[model samples]
Target: MIEIKDLHKSYKMGSNELHVLKGINFNVAEGELVAIMGSSGSGKSTLLNILGMLDEADAGSYTLDGIPIKNLNEKIAARYRNKFLGFIFQSFNLIGYKSALDNVAMPLYYQGVKRAERTEKAMHYLEKVGLANWSDHLPNELSGGQKQRVAIARALASEPKVLLADEPTGALDTKTSYEVMDLIQGINDEGKTILIVTHERDIANMTKRIVNLKDGIIIDDSKVEQVKASANV
Candidate 1:
């Protein structure tokens, strides 16, 4: 479903180029759940941003569901991103004044969905995340876990082909983190491709495969997890 070859990304840092990604070759098949794990400054997040089309790759061949995206103009990239992918971030990225339902509906609003239709569709996703009752509550009224659930709901409400989660369980207690992971696994089982970037080894092992990065390079990838299911948390 996704393919990236010989990808390179660099940023200017005080006259020295910070070469974040050095020839990353990535591939994700449909219905697969993959976790990207790496240390700080290892370029995991940079890779995620490039995969999400939020950041430009200095050089690469990238295709999503058969459409080449390596050199798309910003406008075309944004259109493809909104239509084909969803993003959930570490920060929960919800509007403070909006209710959970409204926040989930926001993406559809930008996509030109009618107000009533968007609300109803957003509610379905909210319920899927087990937050239907909290639909009317604002972000401040929810726990960190609930806020993240709302973020996931918002991401899923767009009905994109893939979900990109960056540090998805980073800002939660142990219990809440596992809850979120279970929720994400459920979503993955329903056939949406999931790509997650996380620093936690435990969380990475919860997915179908775990890939490790170092110095902007993939050092390891495993289809069989070293972590047992009983210790998913």
Candidate 2:
């Protein structure tokens, strides 16, 4: 579903150029649950940004679903990003004043979905994330786990082709992280492609495959026996 070849990125600081991603060759098949694991400065975040279309690689080819992603006009890039990707972040990027329902419906609102249909779709996803009861609650009223659930619901509301999560469990406790990972596992079981950027070994174990990055290169890529997050929870 996704492909990258010889991906390279670098940034300049005064007169010096610091190369982040030297050369990254990667691929993720549809329905695959993969983790991109790296320590700080490993370029995982840069790769994720490139994949999310928030940043472009200095050199490389990226293809999403079959469309080459490079040099897109801002308008076209925004459209493609909205159409193809859903994001979950370490910090639950929820609006404080918006109710769970409203937050979930926000994407559809941008998609120009009518209020009635948006509400219906948002409610469906809320229920899917087990947040229907808290639809009327604001982010502050919800617990961390609940807030993440709301975020997950909001991400799913758009029905995007891929879910890009950055340290999704970093803010939660072990138990809560397990619960959230369990939810994520269930979603992947249903055949949604997911790529998680995480440094946690246990969290990486929960995924079907692990791609380890160090100094901008993949050091290890292997499929493992998937550990059930529910078992850990």
Candidate 3:
């Protein structure tokens, strides 16, 4: 569903340049749950940003769901991003003043989904994440897990083809993280393609494949026997 070849990225810092990704080639198939694991400064975040189309690569080719992603104008990029990608972040990125339902509905709102239909779709996703009863609660009122669940629901509400989660369980306790991974695993079982950028080995093990990044390059990429996060939860 996704393919990238000979990708390279760099950032300039005054007179020096930091090369973040070096000739990276990667692919993710439909309905696959994959984890990109790396330590600090390992370029995983850069890779994720490129994959999400939040940032353009300095050089390389990226194709998503058969569409080549290159030199997209901002307007067209935003349109494709909304149509094909859903993002979950470590921070849970919810508006403080918005209720859970409103937070989940925000993406759809921007997509020009009508009020009633967006509300209905958001509520369905909230319930899918087991947060229907907490729809009216504010982010501050919910636990960290609940807030992340709301974020996941918000991501899902877009019904995008690919789900990109960066450090999805990074801010939660062990049990809570496992529970969230369990929810994520369940979602993948239903045919959604998901990619997780994580630094935690255990978190990566929960996925079907692990892509290890070091020194701005993939050192290992292999499928493994999946570890069910629910067992740990």
Candidate 4:
């Protein structure tokens, strides 16, 4: 579903260049739940950004669902992002004034989905995330978990091939984190390819595979027995 080979990224700082990702190689198959785990400055976030097509790699290749992801114009990049990737951020990234339903519908709006269809798809995903009853509530009106669920629903509304979550359970309490992970696990069970970037061991264990990054390279990549988040919840 996703492929990366010899990936390299860097940023210029004044006269010096900060090498972020150095010769990283990775691949993810369809219907797999994977976690990218790293400490500060380990380059996991850079890898995520490249995988999401939010940023370009200075070197190497990335192919998503048979489409080469290099040297595209912003218009084409945005189109591919909408067509291939869904994102879940730690902060939820919801508009303060938009209700949960409206927030979920925003992506569909960008895709030029009509009002009626957008509303239908938004409500369907909201219900899937167990947030149908809170559709009218604004981000400020919901709990942290509820807000993240709304974000997840918004991400899924586009029906992208890959889901990339950055620190998905970082802000919540343990129980709430488990609940969110449970929700994510359920989504993966239904054959959605999901990649979560997190530092928390327990959260990474919830996934089927863990890719450990250090100093801009993958240090360890291994599959583990998946731990069901529902048990922890």
Candidate 5:
């Protein structure tokens, strides 16, 4: 579903170059749940941004589905991103004034989905996340778990092909972190390709496959068949 080849990105900070991604290579098949694992300053977030189409790789090829994206204009890239991607961030990114339901429906509104239909779908997603009763609550009205759930609902409401999450559980306590991961796993179970970027080993272990990075290049790739069994159990 997604492929990155020979990616290189760097930022000029004063007189020094802050190299972020260095010749990174990876591919995620359709419907797979995978994690990018790394330490601080290891470029996991940079890779996530490139994959999400929010940032460009200075030198590399990114192909989503089958289209090469290294040269897509900003407008075209944005359109493709909105049409096929769902994003969850550590900060939750919900507007303070908007209720969970309304926040979840924002993408649909951008897609020109009729108001009634979008509301119906958003509510259904909220209920799926066990937050139907809290639909009218703003982000501040919910607990950490609920806010993350609302974020998940917002991600899923658009029915995108891939879910890109960066430190999704970073703000939650241990129990709430597990809950959020479970919810993300449930979404992956229904055939969404999931790519998570995290520094936490435990969180990375939850994914079926993991790509460990250092200095931006993948140093190890391992398949955890045991995760499948554990998840089922």
Candidate 6:
């Protein structure tokens, strides 16, 4: 469902350039749960950003479900991003004042979904994430895991083709992190392509495959003997 070839990315710092990704190449198929593992400066986040269309690559190619993702105007890129990619961040980027239900509904509202339909869809996703009872709670009112669950619901509310999670379980405790991974594994079982960017070895083992990155290149790529997060939980 996703493909990249010879991807290269760099950032200029005054007279010097910091090369983030160099000759990266990989592919992800539908319903596959994959984790991109790397250390802090290994370029995992840069690769994820490019995959999510949040940033452009300096060279090479990226194809999301067969569409070339290069040189598109901002409007079209935004449209494609909204239509195909769903993002989950470590910071749980929810509005402080909004309730969980409303937060989940925000993306649909932006899509011009009517009030009734969006509310129904949002509630469905919230319930799917086991947060229906917490709908009226605000971010600050919920625990870290709860807030992350709300974020996951919000990401899924868009019904996008790919789910890109950046350090999704980074802030939660071990049990909570395993629980969240269980939820993500369940989602992948239902045929949605999921890509998680995490440095934790145990967390990466929860995914079906692990792609190790070092110095901006994929050092190892292989399917793993999936470890059940539910067992750990």
Highest-lDDT candidate: 4
RMSD of each: 1.7, 0.6, 0.7, 0.6, 1.9, 0.8
Number of the candidate with higher lDDT, 2 or 4: 4
Global CA lDDT of candidate 4, please? 0.96
TM-score to true structure, per model: 0.95, 0.99, 0.98, 0.99, 0.95, 0.98
- What stretches of model 5 exceed 4 Å from their correct place? 226-233
lDDT of 1 at 97: 99
In candidate 1, position 182 carries an lDDT of 87
Query: In model 2, what is the error at residue 214, expressed in angstroms?
Result: 0.5
In the range 59-126, model 2's lDDT, one tens digit per residue, is: 98999999999999889988898899999999999999999999999989989999999999999999
Model 1, CA-based lDDT: 0.90
Q: Give the Å error, residue 222, model 5.
A: 0.8
Worst 10 residues of 6 by lDDT: 73-82
lDDT (0-100) at residue 121 of candidate 6? 95
- Distance from true location, Cα of 146 in model 6, Å: 0.5
lDDT comparing candidate 2 with the true structure: 0.96
All models: lDDT? Answer: 0.90, 0.96, 0.95, 0.96, 0.88, 0.94
- Cα deviation at 66, candidate 3, in Å, is 0.7
Model 3: which residue pairs collide? none
Off by over 4 Å in 4: none
Q: Compared with the true structure, what per-residue lDDT tens digits does model 1 show for residues 5-91?
A: 998989999989998899989899999999999999999989888888888888888889998887778988888988999999999
Pairs clashing in candidate 5?
Answer: none
- At residue 187, candidate 2 shows an lDDT of 96
Report the CA-based lDDT of candidate 3 relative to the real structure. Answer: 0.95
Q: Residue 93 CA error for candidate 1 (Å)?
A: 0.5
